[model samples]
Target: MTLALAGGALAQDAQKGGTLRIVGTADLDHFDPTSGALVTTNNFLRATQRTLISYHASTDEEERIRPVGDLATEVPQPTNGGLTYTFHLREGAMWNTPGGARQITSTDFERGVKRMCNPALGSAMLTYFVSLIDGMDTFCDGFAEVEPTVEAMKAYIEENDISGITQPDDLTVDITLSETAGDFIYMVSLPTSAPAPIEVLDYMPDGPEYRENFIASGPYTPVDYVPDASLTLARNPAWSAEADPLRAANVDNIEITFGIQPDAAIQQLQAGDADMVYDITIPPAILSLLTATADDKVMTMSAGRTAFLFINTVSDNNGGALKDLRVRQALNYAIDKTALVQQMGGPAMAQPQSGIFGAGVLGYHDFDLYPSEGDAGDPEKARALLAEAGYPDGITLKMPYRNQNNQPEIAQTIQAAMAEAGITLELTPVTASDYYSKFMTNPRNTEEGAWDIAPVGWAPDWVGGAARSVFQPQFTFDGRHQTYNYTDYNNPEANEVAKQAINATTPEEAARLWAQVDELVMADAPVVPYYSEQVVLYRGPAVENFQPYALGGQGDWTNVWLNR
Candidate 1:
């Protein structure tokens, strides 16, 4: 399991073995791989967990997202007409067990997949698996009927099996998908697919008890984690460089400090007090200053992310007006996209989006269903639509925004534009960590009409040829809403087209169908898509072998070496 190093800074002789400090604002969503939802979570888990397949930590934009063998000895080609993936696990990929070093095997992956529908904080990326893997839905349905306690969850896991997955031997894993998916390799590369040890079955998924008894399959083992405060990861005795090709494990220890503002974090980086950021993006003002100074430390990378106002079509607010197509279109017409882009640090960092797909995502194409003057928006068009929808005077709507990275300002911008179109907005602010977990992703909130529209953002689950990653999780393909679908909006036409796009034999055919799905989804106006986001990052002077992680939208933490 060896490959040539390919990061932009890997050419330099890396002075290995030092403590690399990481600073950030928000705490990690999950310490466990099966439950990780955020890109930052993926970044953090890379140090402590090993997936079946993984992308290299490279500065090359395209190469960084390409999947290669990690815990698996080699990336396998599909057999049985592309529905079968047989992973050959590497021998030396060991877990830091209390008993001693223990080799991870096929059963660990089986347990990991079974834990997805745990009645406790279950896997947010469960949608990716249940639909693709054969009999997974049945397993999840059966598991859901069990009690939420750790004992019950573990009992059910032990008693049942997912029929799609099988263990031929200790080191061999066989996964049978119901349908052939071309990008299944990339899907396996995600943290959600990482193998879970038997010890984890004793605790609830991602509970404090599980975090305390953290195990490691990668170069580092997480320890001393305090939610929203700090964490420290020390070298894992069980891990060896030969077992995995993706991470260098140059840093002997990794220290993480939380609750630091982005502006202050950037300054700390320049002073060599920190190596990288954990979760927050650099402030636009600070990024501008760094860019103007021609700082090589500054990195501007393309993120397969989109920022938008997610409309609650399920809400009964304004007399269930959001469900009306005319009202939803009015909401889109009333948004000043140029203002939104400027708040996101101008066109250099973001572009006004007109469709569901983000810029650089596989199926993305230029299309404007609601064309506005200079992207400044059309208040007249909105008002006309509002009148047509029976809101003669105006409609009042609630908007909640995450309190991080210029979002409050962006929300204000949304409020001002909506005002011009006879729509009044009531604003609510939420902490970044709780924004999704407590408020938005909870379908009950939308059903209760707690929020009419909310500022939301999304990065694809995987990078290349990932239209399915973007569209599938966030949209309703069947009657059921997946993880990221905030409003639970459904369209039968869009669902059928999405199936076609994902199953298409060629990239050309897939893109064409995905493009059609995008139009069908937008025509319903479930969300007022604003901009495709590009993140600007700054690393500390001591951070060497730095690479732009397209998913994390920051420098690679697991692979980079410390220079100081």
Candidate 2:
């Protein structure tokens, strides 16, 4: 097995000191690491955030997903029946502070976890910690009652304590989990678990004041940030290449300009006006043009991102038809995934998916329960299933899709296909930024039938052995904070198996258990899995070392330097 951050620098000439321009249409969901849920946010944070363990910008498949030390000295092994973990802060993982660049302490790490449960703009992934950490749920429940004001939040954090997290010394951080989890290290690798400086408590989490007084624990510090418009990054003087292994800090500065269309953004890159893309994938036409010309700058890679449609079981639309497994299965069988694939930029860019786990993910295996000839849906079978489910007169569903990229076209394709089987779709196009924050993650939207179905995408939170990343967050529900589990789907039997997989002794054992959970989840038919997508990334002429990072589905910001 390969170690994470093994020679973190990409294989490129040691060229340095140039501005890398990033163009996109969406602003970051949140500036604070704790609240960041988007892949683009993680990519940007790789430049300025430090977690206990982090992924390296390595090209090797095995090395890229491995967890490596960042703020922590190393990836620590668990003791006490895999329930307890102790990690020491490294020598020079410093935070850009008011007084000076101070070494981040274990106290900062503990504070970061404490801030994860803050009622105001806290982490969407807080359930991962609250469910695993021994006393975190109790702390979060009490904190939820406090005023959302900075003083109240700050006082609660300082006054209360989580028995699961402790600081033995200024540098040593210890954690006690409720159960053994083989993939626990990958959870901490998330940007949400990064250490937070004490200065952040003065402002609402990720508010204007917090962004203005932003601190840096990684290579770059953000400045001059205008919401959905532009942001600038400057090299942090405190960042030492000798002290850090995950990022090389090759560029002197970064300028992110939002609101650029995909076509215009790619044109800028071709014209050498921009060095990289920010939020959008390359337009299919542009990808074709570049690939036809055998352009060296154009590269297609897999980042384990899969697109699917989540069925609203909680919705009462059409007399709650979606709550029936047969109706969901009918929707699955009726979707012409082949047409969906063509709309996704052809066979080269996407492959039809039929199960909960996307292709190449840890638990993924080829299995389409609703088999169709030529992979082209069976409308007759779908009509029969709908009739059996008491929707013989046909049913209508409201579906929302992100307006950005080719989703609008995909939504139309789905509408046209399902129409053949007596399923009427009233499609609603949504803003990319608001699609998750305002719609899908809101359980009320599901209950109120605001949207009975939606096309959504998922990329692993951390890559290697990340079955939980795909399943636990997006599928299972424990009645905690409603998050990626948009459909209110819950299977206690499968969830228990997930717990068993998490505690499995070996990779093979865990993978076997994960596969079982995948099969079980599909039997319930909560989501209509569509296609596993291939990423098309275009780098500017001046961009160098544009290595593919699995987590971000784009070039690694920590590795890319500018030849210009």
Candidate 1: what lDDT? 0.85
For each of the candidates, the C-alpha root-mean-square deviation to the true structure, in angstroms, is 1.8, 2.5
Per-residue lDDT of model 1, residues 387-415, tens digit only: 99899898999999888867778899999
Error of 2 at 419 (Å): 0.9
Query: In TM-score terms, which candidate is top?
Result: 1
Query: Per model, how many backbone clashes are there?
Result: 0, 0
Clashing pairs in 2: none
**What TM-score would each prediction reach against the true structure?**
0.97, 0.96
Q: What's model 1's TM-score?
A: 0.97
